[model samples]
Target: MGSIKPAKSLLYLAISMVIGGTLLNVNELAYLAVFPLILLAMGLFVEPPSGIKIERIVEEKTYIPGDEVTIRVKVMIERGMGMVLLRQPLPPEVELVKGNNAWSLFKGPRKLEKELTFSIKVPRRGLYTLPPAELYIEPLLKLGKPGTAFLGNPVTITVLPLIKPPRRVRTTNTRSQIPIPLTSYSLTGPISTDFKEIRDYRPGDPVKFINWKATARRGNVLVNEYEREGKKTVMFYVDARPTMSVGTFQENPLEHAVSLVASLAYYFLRRGYNVGLYIVGRGELMMPSTGNRQLYAMVKKLMEVEVLSSANEDFKDAMRKSERIIIQYTPLIIVVSNLLQANELREAFRLLMKHYKGRVPSIVFDLFPYSMFSGKKVELVRLRKIAIERELKAISHVVHWDIRKTEISAVLAKTIRMVR
Candidate 1:
């Protein structure tokens, strides 16, 4: 706040003139300079700006790498007359596409409103928070101290991974049969003849759902759990460990894998399949559901997904909790990750194979981030990749994706064996 008067250039000039006029005995010049000092002193009565407010408005927020977002930042300075300076600090990863983040303007009297509009391109995936707006108001006459204020509300943007539509290559009347053990089971749902497990009857159990045979054998009342059709669920297991951070942050293996997951989720959800996601980092399952809302939920979670700094992920625990869902929906499994030198990834596959009873038609979008690196071992990585492919091929349809050489869509087109 500008609560005290500070001597300005005009005050100093007037003092110098009076001192000179005393030595020279010239009253007219000193009196004229005194008028300037009096006017400058009147500026101290002007209050510094207060009631400063800032608001951020975003338009058509398309959150993905390389996508531009238009941001409109408005500032309302309601109190003092001054020169206004407003600044909105952006993260280093965000690039300005147009306009400016900082602007300076002259302000006068009551309610001065200003707008700083710009377009920015976010270059990576993560949760980004733009710092609070900073406002500096200096007196219009430059005769008093300036005032500063900050609006503490920050703007947070979650940049989700980009999804590229897979190239569709449809075949007629032919399905690829691979060698894998297959089994069938059922879990809870409505309107299907498939029998789920039998359990002791609860109060709400219908008489029709009673398993008389099991009741007779166990000597206890039992009711059958049910399964249904007309709705399907696809569960995605995204491996987001630091290993997926193989290339540059923007073009790394994890980024592409996340995008692949998003695209697959979108594709299946668009067809009315109830979709779910299990991010390996946090190991939380997004329950399966169908709709624009489900897709929104999945993408929103995916936007917050990042390659964790620690590798201590619990894949088995995450899977165990999701086992009932796996059995209930008999969902087609899609595991997205970079498998090179990843022992955890291999273990995850072995664990997953047991669930859908080795028959959960699964797809592994295996990332090849070898060539993206520079070293003599690039060739060695390529060799080891083949061995890993053999292991994955035993249980799932493997799409070998070379990030340095190809896009995810192309690999899917060539090797996509969609189970649903």
Candidate 2:
């Protein structure tokens, strides 16, 4: 049941009756009091609205950051009575991109249903749920309080990271070029031991490589020739320890590191290189494969990385575990981290050097914690900067990058230059 509130018309009638009874004839104004009493009784006994159905529909359930989603709400009333108001509260992760969230409608005899539509833009990546909507009904004649009812079911939306195409970089080694038509498995470059065909010997051809059997048949000097296969293996190690979480939600070291790893993985995989990912965080996540499938797997894993409050031994353990694999394949290893501690950085470099012995082209990308230095004392900042610099310099081949200062393309370009 809806409660009653004294209307302005009722208040006006009450005042007129009092003045008329006091200053004029009391009997003449006595009839005016009945009008206000009748209005009050009607408002007090007004029944609340019931038998309403609400349905909600969303345009899409999955999207990337900055995608606009439309939500449509339909409200149907079995019996039309009084004025109804509808409101839907938006999730914190999204902002109202367009349209109104609240709708007020008068339920007349001819009208039994109403529809409300709105749009929201998701600004970040994660899973979010839309809250239920609310419905309020006011008494007839605009004289009573409003009664509320919850209207729609909740909806979940998963927002993936925004992936932009990486800039093309020319590889330093001409042998690294991808073939026009890719094969399942092939050698990266020509080797004298892996001969393919025999051709007429050139003037400068080495004697050891000349095939005696071919020369005996043709009576001409024929040299063994080999075809260079363009296939390489690359491994990316992303540091997800607690120290990498130093920054605001909008810009953090860990997020930048994730993006870097994703871009590089995509870049190498497009060039027909077998790519592997090892995330060092709460638990090690490894996806050792190649092609588009491996790239998607790495992206999915990278999207789920979160900041932890405590440190884990996964980073050190992962490096140790990867030692044998690195030595066997001699794949290019790229370690992306903040290098916050001197001891940890030294240990990682030592492990890589011990196993590969500089045979593998390794790169250490130092994600400088520049954003974390904001609002700090000058002396403290200087000390921290010096410490980071010293730790990075201790490593043999380190690339220092500040995400806040430049874009990921520039960083990739720098890596390409270093490779050359």
Candidate 3:
């Protein structure tokens, strides 16, 4: 509603009545004459005219939850003769920690122009609106008149969700790229590689086979030696399976897993080894490759990985083929997954060595510890859940990882140390 203003003549009548009544009794003046004259003066003079306008501006367009943002309101008034009060309205989620009460009075009016700025923190992630401002004005008269009012337009702010790294991780029992010893190799000549270590010298030892350090420690000479093998390849198998979604909220487990895969790819590529990747569970395959380009491709893939549904296909066939690839072209394989499926996990890894052209060294990153999936109480009666966990651990030796309720970077660092 607009400001309420009583007719000025009302005040004049009350003033004139008192003055005329006293004068008629004491000075013998005409009461009607004095009252009518004062009333006419009040009605003839017009109250000062006024108008107000408000413009709003914001400091930022996007922010994460709990981020601070400032909003500025510029108030302008024209020919405003009187006291003007302005009050800014704010959203329910926004707290006006600064500025005057919903109202600020502009004393002794002239033309008024001002830019009032305020700041607020984004408490939640979503869209929000800035409330309107209430403008009030009152003429400088003793008549006790009401003030004018107006509501400004609404403003909107959008907040984005928080993407934080995990504290720990849960690794699954999947195939990996560790070195495996070969069983069917013919000796080309005498062993000539650098000495690795020396135990008691085997029978039929050559006179030059003695190790001085071993002799001093064991009271007898021990020989140290090494075997020769061709250069080996390193491949990373990431189980991006649907079943891997046991633990995650706004930040999915796959995001962290993908980072690990990408990092390993970079390291292997830098080491002059052919680094390849096998992505299981999402029905997509990235065969192993080496070079900077390959590493970037891996990072791009990992960045876009979304969690798979429960019905997503398995990588058992890929696991079987991994053996041959390792024997013919690769020597090391690193498997990373949340080992939620025991049989599938076992079969995938077992087939690697069993079906490979040669022995394959492997390290499994087992993302178990279903406890990390949630803080709520887990039902023990879920026979399938229990069975899956049991099979996961029994299938292959896995490097256990639990990424639940922890910072992602810290957990990844720990996992890297463990694998090393």
Tell me which of candidates 1 and 3 scores higher on TM-score: 1
TM-score of each: 0.79, 0.68, 0.43
List where candidate 1 sits over 4 angstroms from the true fold: 1-9, 19-28, 109-111, 140-142, 176-230, 314-317, 341-360, 415-417
The candidate with the higher TM-score, 2 or 3, is 2
Number of colliding residue pairs in each model:
0, 1, 41
For residue 173, model 1's alpha carbon misses the true position, in angstroms, by 4.5
Q: Over the stretch 296-375, how does candidate 2's per-residue lDDT look in tens digits?
A: 88888887777766856655687777766555445676888776556775666667776543433567777766644665
Q: Candidate 3: what lDDT?
A: 0.58
Best by TM-score: 1
Lowest summed lDDT across 10 adjacent residues in model 2 is found at 176-185
User: Sorted on TM-score, highest at the top, how do the candidates line up?
Assistant: 1, 2, 3
User: For residues 330-403, what per-residue lDDT tens digits would candidate 3 score against the true structure?
Assistant: 44567777654567656666666554434335556665436554434544423445566555544433555555
The lDDT values for all models are: 0.74, 0.70, 0.58
TM-score of 3: 0.43
Better of 1 and 2 by TM-score: 1
Clashing pairs in 2: 188-229
